[model samples]
Target: MSTRAPDRFHVSSAVVLCTPGAADRLVETLAEMPNVEVHAAEQGKIIIVIEGKSSGEMGATLAAISSLPDVMAANMVFEHAENLEEGLINGHRTDAA
Candidate 1:
């Protein structure tokens, strides 16, 4: 018998462009979202990292961000997925296959 692991953990980074002087408000709003991290903000660009159980969840979050007022665009820059159970069992990363 075998037990299957849960869904892969998905991580993604995005560059969010906002209208002039909206970075501060956007950062504050993003900070309140679960599993979302604001890495930096300068000028009108905000760097954010988000984590989720699946790619669909991450994509949905990105879409929501892009639709926010003052947001000009939200583009994903990086993405990675890993099987946490496999990584933990081997004590090293065992990225999804």
Candidate 2:
């Protein structure tokens, strides 16, 4: 049997820094973006998760977040990608094929 590579999956965790007294506004703005989830907010910093089918999409979203008003910076803490087809053992797919 022949197998094909799986679709791309990208996940990124980032910390967005807000200007003084700007955390609330930043959180609201982030909430409006697609595939962006605000996990926590405190002391001018917001923890967020970005997910997309491709890394390029995630990067664009991150850049957009950084450009929002009162956003001081958006720094990626971690990033990961997985190919579903690669999760195989003994030439058998670990996940549903």
Residues 2-97 of candidate 2: C-alpha lDDT, one tens digit per residue: 465567789999999989998987788888889999999999999999999888999999999888899889998999987755776545667755
Best by lDDT: 1
TM-score of 1: 0.84
Q: How many residue pairs collide in each prediction?
A: 0, 0
Of candidate 1, the 10-residue stretch with the lowest lDDT total is 87-96
Model 1 C-alpha lDDT per residue in residues 1-97, reported as the tens digit of each score: 2355545889999999999988898999999988899999999999999999998999999999999999999999999997756744434444654
Top-TM-score structure, candidate number: 1
Model 2 error, position 24 (Å): 0.9
Each model's TM-score? 0.84, 0.82
After TM-score superposition, what is the CA distance of residue 58 in candidate 2 from its true location, in Å?
0.7
Summed over model 1, clashes come to 0
